[model samples]
Target: MTDYGNIDVEQFFTGDPIEDWLDLKRREDISTGTVDSLVQKLQTNSDGTAFQQFLSNRDVGVLDATVMDLYDYRDFIREVNSKREMKNKLSEVSTFYNDMRRLKQTDSNPAAFVLSRTDTRVKLPNREYHTVEAMGDFLAFIPHPQMQTMCLCYLKYGLRRGAVVNIDLCCVNIDDPRYRPILMNAISNFIGRYAAVRIPYIFTETSAQMMWLMVRNVATETSATTMSYFRSTTR
Candidate 1:
């Protein structure tokens, strides 16, 4: 036998069906965090993980899954977890099977049938709406300038937390001739390190440019202060 030195073994393993599905997602440029969460959910069954117990069985391949098997899994999920969690888990499984169908690995998505059942059972409350006055009162309660600026940006732009945190110094471009009262463009790091996406924030009452300028100045000043404190402590 020929000796193969220091060859990575992972290249050959190729992972289980669940992992294989997640790998397909990664190839499509899905975020690592999102894919990892799906994998975790697939591996963690009510009794012993849906993937390991159902899809991984050689005798009962994914293509062989019927609506009854899916219903059994749904009952198992409901037994082990809350209704909300069950809905979420079933949704993930449905998405996985749907994607598998798209890949021509399966002819039907049993998970989709199960998901529809769960959706009908779950009744989530309506999302709360905050008025302008309520928002003003909340803003007045915040003490830190950086936190206030960040919150204002999020409120004004309806940005997610990840988007708000990803705003970079380069995102501030007041000198551009096309610059309106709004920041026009803000960089959000929602897609992890792969790329920075442009997100625009519109100002209805407050000056968007001024808000961004404050964000930049406060963020820089806060960073400098924190570093200075760390240096002093270290010295």
Candidate 2:
């Protein structure tokens, strides 16, 4: 009907969710951002079918799976699938694949059948030091102020990524007897080792006092020298 300029709709999508989900690869993590995005966009089974058709037409032998399964072993699955040689042999691959038609039939681990294809699960942590650019790209999804604080604590203090949320002033002190020495001890041991500090979130009255006292002591120390002889040393 009407003439329209050549436009690619693929350029329109921002891929924010996909990027967030993919970033987990650096941390040995997995997320259902892709499936969740699909589920949210695909309200009915027919929508899933449409996607299935698209995959099939593309000769992608992908199989349907739940969220949990995907998270548990996304890395291994990704590695195996990413083989460039396989592209020439196979159009697509499945983690729990079977080759019953072959003379030497084989089946994948049975546990794989029950695994979820959607969810967040991490079996390992990234061992190699993350480059600044890589970490920035991974953390860029989180922009909220408080969330940024939480992320910083993870990168700076080495706290577990998710555990940062439950903590408040009560449960954390740079010098609490239960926590301070341990963290300091860890830091002293790992001046450059970069160990993480994990503090259980257990708020209490003592923690409040301890933190306050530490702050007061710090203020007193810093000002003590500055305030001394302020009126007249020369006079």
Candidate 3:
């Protein structure tokens, strides 16, 4: 939603005020952020025409109608009640209209604007991390060269750590001289497992598994040294 946007607000409460309901929901043990976001999403719909129409039809000269007045029979009330299905769509339509308005090229509705609160959460862009000493110790453990070569081979071929530890069969190909003899075998599913399906790889010995191990050792050591400095500083 645009920060510069505002429109006159009209409130409609068919059975109960929505904000009151949100207040009650917030009083429970549920997530505070969820409650806040829900209220914010609803408040975004200030320019809803159908909402305005619903309010317009029901507006009294004064807010003096008794509880019994709502149930009292009127022909137009029955017609309006028949259109109850349309009320919920107003939020969605208003959002769509606002999207068009932001383009500022073709949207004709000068009055249309979304009034939602801006998201407070912001994600910073990704950047390379500085290396330190602990990272070297961890990498040192990988190139142990004794364990059956599968441990080092797995990482050497760029396979995941978990996959390296778990694979017993053809994952570590011992006979191939041209390749690193380690292969990426399996990953799981989207809704199901931690990762989905297998991605296959065949790396030549020329791919330099030994060099990768050396680099990993250097990086891990550098990271660990950095962490030790921070620990001392904090203490």
Best by TM-score: 1
Error of 1 at 17 (Å): 29
Name the candidate, 1 or 3, with the larger TM-score value.
1
TM-score order of candidates, top first: 1, 3, 2
Which scores better on TM-score, 2 or 3?
Answer: 3
Worst 10 residues of 1 by lDDT: 187-196
Candidate 3 global Cα RMSD: 22.5
TM-scores of the models, in the order given: 0.19, 0.16, 0.17
**How do the residues 81-166 of candidate 2 rate in per-residue lDDT, one tens digit apiece?**
67856775564344324432242335544344334443445333212343456445444533346744554444543423222322
Give the count of colliding residue pairs in each prediction. Answer: 1, 12, 19
Candidate 3 stretches greater than 4 Å from native: 1-93, 105-148, 152-235
Candidates' lDDT values, in order? Answer: 0.53, 0.42, 0.44
Q: Comparing 1 and 2 by TM-score, which wins?
A: 1
What TM-score does prediction 3 earn? 0.17
